[model samples]
Target chain A: MTHPAEIKALVFDVFGTIVDWRSGVARGAAAFLDRYAPALDPYAFADAWRAEYSPSMEEIRSGRRRYVRLDVLHRENLVRTLDRYGIVDVPDADIDALNLAWHRLDPWPDAVAALHRLKRRFIIAPLSNGNIRLMVDVAKRAGLPWDAILGAEVVRAYKPSPQVYSDTVEILSVAPAELCLVAAHNGDLAAARRLGLSTAFVLRPTEHGPGQTTDLQADDAWDFDVKDLNELADRLGCPD
Target chain B: MTHPAEIKALVFDVFGTIVDWRSGVARGAAAFLDRYAPALDPYAFADAWRAEYSPSMEEIRSGRRRYVRLDVLHRENLVRTLDRYGIVDVPDADIDALNLAWHRLDPWPDAVAALHRLKRRFIIAPLSNGNIRLMVDVAKRAGLPWDAILGAEVVRAYKPSPQVYSDTVEILSVAPAELCLVAAHNGDLAAARRLGLSTAFVLRPTEHGPGQTTDLQADDAWDFDVKDLNELADRLGCPD
Candidate 1:
């Protein structure tokens, strides 16, 4: 797979690719569980917490409920995760603070360097499920030098939705061909590729924590595939 | 005036404030008119073209017409300006290309450095009447570093509508106090202040060209009244 010559902007999928959410959440949850409740299975709890992401968003998407930011959604889902495991000792303030752990999620080592390099040539932004405020908070915390932040909050539609990707490109006034979607998830890239967007796959082998299996390899013919964002930047000509 | 600690972000009024639109349009129009018809008074034509902005937008606001982007509004206004000036020699393509002069407007000298310095400490975006694509283009052309671009296109409500400014703060998830309205126009800043946003008045004495009369001096006790954006940054603790 080759880079499209016309590609001028690169939009990233943040969660698994740019930030190691699984391990970050796991570490944060493990630390909390260790101090608060040693009896809980931290790994299962981490998986369960992430498991709620889809259905929680679905509740809003299907119009079953009004729009809720990821922070609120995360708290709602956290209570359920705790209830299922019979662990209710955590206080509300602690839970509220912990929910913001999403903001402090650590990026992949290669993430910052790659983005910094890529920013030199392309208009770089994160087209993510996170809300604008959440993304901005994360960027400031992680020092991710994003040129702009474009998120589901702007369009009120989550990724894999053609509207989200198309609206993003339209907002930038760049042809779909000039924008590339870089992600660790195949489904995200596949959706973007279908909409005439170029695609790049950056492998995040440990994104799902210790037993993670999927997305460890680029299973599709994306425009570019690299070990990390720094390599992608090198390939894109971001100077050292 | 003391800096409002509550204001964490600053949104700008672009047209006459950050960019010298009158001169830009006049210069571009003169070149365009010269190429099309040698006889038209480019200065009067520029004023005539600009004179259509408010009424055209008002038509959309009153539901007398559909929501038309500033680009389309400029084109419509340009045609009428050409007709009034008896300029019959211009082709449609040239007119269409020249109507994009708004996109090519030059930034005021203080605009870039002030925005750049302020961006180091806070999130900076344009809360302008320009459509999304137009603002994005202007930022790229003028090298204005914005964390995100917010405009009337997002809310479909023009400035001073409260909905426009409030929707911007809501979308960015910043409280009204956490956002400052920085503009050369009192009407715009007044509306923002009414909505509980902090106000910063930067004087653009020549915004209306040499015939400018109003907004030559800051009238009210704005939170910060500075000569330029750099001065604003210096007051705000941007590094020297």
Candidate 2:
């Protein structure tokens, strides 16, 4: 965890780390539900939709299903979440557009500038569970300056699975310790650290919206623990 | 062959299409030769080094060898090419750096600006034989505004192979016709076209220097045949 100077690239976790998915999804869902289930809580809808993310990926991670893109998984989860709310009769096109809510997420206020600062020194990319198309859409919409997109789809495995961590490092052709995984989730950091990668934790108090109890702080020691990406950039000696 | 409005992503073929590898490699070889074989023609040296590219890839394309990165192939070819030149006793570090000459190739003058204009209208990425790291290095140094990098290593297959075309289109999550391949080489276009991807032939007349004969003219009818990336951008109706 101490080889700071040796870190050549910093790969990020996207969902709650780079972009505020819950807020964006809620906003998108607000507009979406206004035309459908006006009484449904958009935030609850966002939470409900997100609630299905892990268990759906668990099927693929557990080898019960073959690898598929995140978009496919998201669409599947959206249907299931809709049924949970008893919402029906949504047009296919509307459902498709709503699924892309993930693509339009707004970055943390400090994320973009700090990412540009970090990009000036290190190779920066998303090491998210999102697929390449999803990463590209989010980067284009949010102006995230990524050198490349690397994630679960590239290696056909999701995070915390050993393959996701190892295959991503291998794809980069760098020493495991030389690629840092910057995430808001301690479990993600722990998995990456377990795989010989360096780790940095960015504290996001309301990643799941307050009273969110998880990943609000660094749960364990990390190479760099900071309040935001700006602090992470500053800690790594990137220019302001 | 005429789905102009449908093209959502413009994936490029990098070597002769985006960058002037012959000139850049010859230039790099010239600087390297100043320390060693000043008697050898840098252009000849460049061509000789490039001579191994197809055969090396053919090994993988034919399924006779396991998939390896272009960097690895380049390093192996470097030693062979050096022996062909009867040059030896070079330090491994220097050889390693020289092998990375692929990383430092200069983009054609019109490429970066044209790519920027194209990026505004579509997702732009490299669909090259070069590996991801090589694409990233070239883009960073040359200021190529790629939305992502997609190529041989990403699909673990070389160009003109079915997977190289189908898989890249699949990776972009675009319909084959919705992804346009802008390349200088006709055979590359031919292969892409065969797979139902749209193709544009950007003529790079002097890719092999003044005596360049091949690919100076479009070999077959393509979706768009133009003078350079600038013209290709114009043909695609991208803004100035």
Candidate 3:
């Protein structure tokens, strides 16, 4: 195992690792559906909308489409999801607000407190696919105490891309090995580890809802494995 | 005057406006000089180093050199300043720390508290030439609570450049008019105003020392003229 002493910064995967986006989006979708398409199942609607996230990013990742902020992608996905659900005629204003639901995600129960503790010992920021505005809005609303906003927007590329991790390391002025990427997603950690960044696998078994099968456990021999951010903080010897 | 009510984000010029860099740099230089070059005047050393800032940036802005982070520029400037002061043979480590003096700058007396107040109402960030790492370090050390670090590094250009303000506006996802650029420098505000952003002129008469002549007061008809950040917050209707 790599020594934790070298880790000076901890960049998190935000969507599900730090925030309970599944539940947050479900709640937000429920409110929108109630106001627009009351008969729809908000949970299914949220899952469908979220299911489009990766594929949308894939287009940019594969260079098939130009890069746009996650907010823009989320808006496009929202429109497509609405059509898929056979719900139309939603006002542009309401649709805009619904798109911003990604910005209002709630933290997992232990995320905020743990982040505050970790911030005392490490530079903590999101290294997710979320754009600067979306991350800033989420940080402000969810009380995420980020030292700086770092992510896809800053690098102009989505996560799992070498550019994202490399750019974050360059921005932080830290060696890749001196930075740790914390995530509940195996793919994120895998990509980070391949780029020589330290990796911490955070278990968020219910991230994709109760039946979530993938990333329920650390797939690789990550540098650290912890149940939540708080445990990760404790293992890193952060002061309360 | 433009209405302050439309402003959604408040992007600041950090060095002379939020933090008293002159005093902070002088203090940091004194400590370093005391250990290495005891006979040197730290205040003069600080001024000499700062004097190189604009010219170094101009090189990048004019495309005489490719973009480099402010930290890198500061390091190069530090070595030249030390040589000019006849203080050579300093270890690379000490020189590196001295270059980071910019990151340890102390905020103006009312800056932090006023920022907290303004933060309750607006998205406050440092839109300075300082790179993300420098800004993050300064924010952490000085307790300046910023919503995001948006500046020269993020845009890969120095201030007074259209890319800096335009990219910042794009990142904040706010219309140019909906963002306010707050600074103690007339040139900065003038550049921002030309980009259609609301401008707030802050007074920092002693920024370049007691004899400081420029930017002593508002030069143009700014949208808001305030004595300090506290007054700026009050004029913007931020909570006490």
Candidate 4:
């Protein structure tokens, strides 16, 4: 087992790891749909909208488009998804409000308390694909006690790009070995591990819904494998 | 007086505005000198070291050097100052620690409490020249409750360059008029004002020491002028 003594900071993958984005988005979409397109299935609407997340980022990653902040991309994706559902003529204000639903995600039950505990001993922050504004709004809404805001916007490059991890390490002024990347997804952890950063996996069995087959548990021999954030904090020796 | 209702975020100038860098550096220098060079005048050393700050940043601003983080600039400036004072041969670790004294700056007496009050109503952060690591360290040490970190490294540009202020506004996803730049220095507020951001001036008479002649009071027709952060918070309608 790797010792947690030297880790000075823990950067998190925000969407599913810290907040229940799936449930939050579904709830918000349902409310919006209930008011407008009452016949639409809100859960399917949310899942389809989320399905576009990576492809939207891939456009910038492949240099097919200039880098746009996540908020703009979210708005664009929302419009396209609404079009696919035969829902049109949505007011700009309503569309903007629905797009900001990403910022108001509710943290998992254990997230806030565990993060407060972790924060007492380590610098805690989100290294998400979300831009600074989205992350800031999430932090405020969800009561995440972040020591700093870091993400693709700061480096102007998305994750899985070596630049994102390298820039985070540089900006934090810590060696890769002295920082830990905590995520529910194996891919995020794998990338951090490849870059020589320590990795911790916290299982989120239903992250992609009950049928999720992948990342139901740690897939790689990460530095730490914990059931939840509280356990991760305990493993890191943060006081209860 | 400008209404505070529209302002959603408050971005600060860190060094002289929030933290008393001059006194903090002097205290840290005195401690270092007591062990290594007891005869040295620590205040003069601290002042001489700070005197290099603007010029060091000017190198990057003028494109004479690539953009480097503030910690790196502080280290280089420390080395040159030590050499000028005929003090050399310090251990690399000691020099590094001494350079990081900038990260241990003490917030002004009213800073923490006032910031807590203001944070309830507005998103408060340091839009500083200091990089993320330095800002995070200072926040941890000084108990400044910053909502997010925004600064030079995040934008890859220094203050007074229109890019820094503009990038910050874009990242916060707020209109220039909807964000406020609060600083002790007129130059910072002036730059922000030129870019259409609201500005607040808080007096920090001893920021450059008791003999300070500049920035003793608001020098422009700033949107708000007050004696301290507490007064600024009061004026902003943040509950006491």
Candidate 5:
């Protein structure tokens, strides 16, 4: 079958696709600011934190620093971002609590329902740059029912690398063609396709919130594309 | 509290505790012999195959060879054992099929029911020497309802290693004391307890069938000792 009849597993990109991480962080920070840091601009703070994501990963990739998890990376970025905004005097405990904002990121409205549908047909897991500890914590805190949590920590390599995709297939013991990578980002699907994985694009136009300029729609002729995860599950014939 | 409080996760040792491998292999071999080679002593064949288990693990542990997964080791052992018994007429495909006996292991009668009970209260996973692919396949084939499968493949290290215990605890993001290792063998419990993990022993005295010489009963005081997994769950207040 030219359609790759053996695709038995689906690995998801968590931040934008499965969960509305940007908006979730904005909301979480808004709540935190309302409760404690009343003077902080929660939305601006959320954007600043999201913008630091890549630079922090680059620091690790470039050997400017050793490996650190998203939780630790978020804390470091949070402290620096707060300092940049002239908000010193944040308590260490509060900073620690704020770092967990990522853990509490809310799934998109259709995420849980869609995953529930997909779980009936395939092994679904998070294939992300998040560390295992971070992802597992997020799963527990957010009620994401992943069959397994596959992450950078498992292979100690970041995404867009062929090793990451190959390592996932090796660890899962499934052939490259027997798994599909589902993400909102074209770059992730491009990388996975290079390593022989099938691809599905689920649009998350507001991943960066209003005026999000990238990944607003499918950028390539991916194996499958849908408006959201629920639609993607349906397109794949995952029974409800 | 002397009794463990608020156990949030339960990690299991797979081999003898969950599945009756010895009896399954013996029965399969007896049936295979009855169908193909009436002259063979099927019980002796089963014991010979089982004898390879410890030496295979020892070989890898003592650095006589690289880390070969139990699946590969079983296949190699089966080839040698079948040769010794002069059962060479079996096709290579059949030999490959027979090597998968590990995957076809039958669960102990109480395993599913007790794990179902425990799952209602705790996140359940298998902390096994088996590789991730092996464990996942076994869980699927044997109808094991593990919330996740954590194996040596995750850390590339075998159990009783502090790395394995710490990797699991770190991934689950729980304190060592909040996680308990439940196993049929005493040594497994001793390792967990030494690493500050709560330990529960489920006696599987017949794991090796008649000639079972070790772990016949709880050899040391642990956090909990019960007759079987069901009893252990009851002791832990896992509701029916």
Candidate 6:
């Protein structure tokens, strides 16, 4: 949807759309533990840890468990990933500090610039599943310029859940048609689209590293399709 | 409380602490239709509208009504205040537009500079009763540099409600003592302190009006008591 003055708010799906989390976590992990596990393939370790994310959140989304913040989930996943990799006896304090890697992820090359431009026009924020603290860290460290952080902790549910999108838009006081979700994930955009939230897809070709098989292109008729946030800014008429 | 690196989050009470809402609404109301209510005391109109605030929120805080966003409450108060002043037949749209004066408030002069300095040191956010949209507008327009907006709607209750304080601190994943609330009103700080949240009293002697009778001095031994945000920032070791 065009970002005319009336387009009240635009929410983003953060992980792959705004930041390259895989590379970011890999780098952070390597920095934290290259000496402890010299044979560790950092990128593979990043994938292994991330693999735990969905199932843990699914437990909550399915009502089998109550809501827990992403920071807790990330640390839990971290411990399990370390065990599988035979990295043992790491100090709890060290583990806790390393878990903040999620908070320090690097935004996409186009993200900060595009978001700054968009901020001048739209009430832009993240509707990611990351908890409020997580979103706040990522925005501060990456210069995201979000007006507020909204997601899992606020709504007590994970993404793709209808309430995650619906309740978030309600908090921003924007109708579904006036709220847009820009993401690299079709599943997320499709969920948002089902609830009448406008959608934009940005290609993150290497999000899962070179052999990435999913979300390489806009597979559905999203409201807008772009290669990156810069293109999104252009489409939304944000000037250079 | 000292704002060392350990002070994880500093949540602000926005209305009088950060912004001047009374003069703001008065200006907007006068501009919206000065001819219709030429004899209207703009400041009194502001006070009349604000007088309904606590009683309305008290309904929710007392569990007699469900939580409502501050924007809705403000609009409701505005309509009632207008009727009391003998203004009639104003369209709903104009009232709605004028009610947004809360979103356009001018920050206390020290707020922006001090907050910018404080932002570099702490995770600063507003823990006001304003809804996400209203906080977003106020922060965006006033350049308050908040890391996130955490408040009433997010907690699903208005302030002085223990949940409002407890839940907001939980969102930041900080211990109660690690989160400091800086507000102009002694009562707000007192409520925060009751729940083990650290408190700072920034004196806004004129928050209610020139002859404001309450909260003129720190009534309790708050963790930190100062005359303004600049002094608060200074005591916290944020450099000029």
Per-residue CA lDDT of candidate 4, range B1-240, in tens? 457888999999999999999989998898899887899887888899999999999999888898999998999999999898888789999998899889899999999999999988888889999989999999988889899999898889899888899988988988998999999999999999988899999999999887999998888899999999999898889999
User: How much of the true A–B contact set does each candidate keep?
Assistant: 0.42, 0.65, 0.65, 0.75, 0.38, 0.80
Residue A77 C-alpha lDDT in model 3: 93
Predicted structure 6: lDDT: 0.88
State which docking tier applies to candidate 6: high
lDDT string, candidate 6, A1-240, tens digits: 544444667899999999999999999899766767888788998999999999989998999988898899999999998998889999998899889889999998999999998888888888888999999988888888888888788888999899998898788878887988999999999999888889989999999999999998898988889999989888888887
Model 5, residue B213: displacement in angstroms? 3.7
TM-score of each: 0.89, 0.97, 0.97, 0.98, 0.90, 0.95
Q: How many residue pairs of model 1 clash at the backbone? A: 0
Highest TM-score model number: 4
lDDT of 4 by residue, A65-85 (tens): 988999999999999999988
Superposed by TM-score, candidate 3 places the C-alpha of residue B222 at a distance from the truth, in angstroms, of 0.6
Candidate 2 vs. true structure, TM-score: 0.97
In candidate 5 chain A, where is summed lDDT lowest over 10 consecutive residues?
Answer: A1-10
| Root-mean-square deviation of candidate 3 | 1.4
User: Model 6: per-residue lDDT, tens digit, B1-240?
Assistant: 544555778999999999998889888888765766887788888898899999989999999989888998899888888888888999888888898888899998889999999998789999999998899998899988989889898889988989989998788888998999999888888888888898989998888889899888999888888988989888888888
> By summed lDDT, which 10 consecutive residues of candidate 6 chain B come out lowest?
B1-10
What TM-score should be assigned to candidate 3? 0.97
Q: Which parts of model 1 are misplaced by more than 4 Å?
A: A1-3, A26-35, A38-45, A87-92, A234-240, B1-3, B41-43, B64-68, B88-93
Off by over 4 Å in 6: A1-6, A31-36, B1-5, B32-35
Task: After the best TM-score superposition of candidate 4, give how far the Cα of residue A66 lies from its true spot, in angstroms.
Answer: 2.3
lDDT of each: 0.82, 0.91, 0.91, 0.90, 0.80, 0.88
DockQ of each: 0.46, 0.75, 0.80, 0.84, 0.49, 0.81
Best by DockQ: 4
Q: How far in Å is the alpha carbon of A39 misplaced in model 1?
A: 4.6
Chain B TM-score for the candidates in order: 0.94, 0.98, 0.97, 0.97, 0.90, 0.96
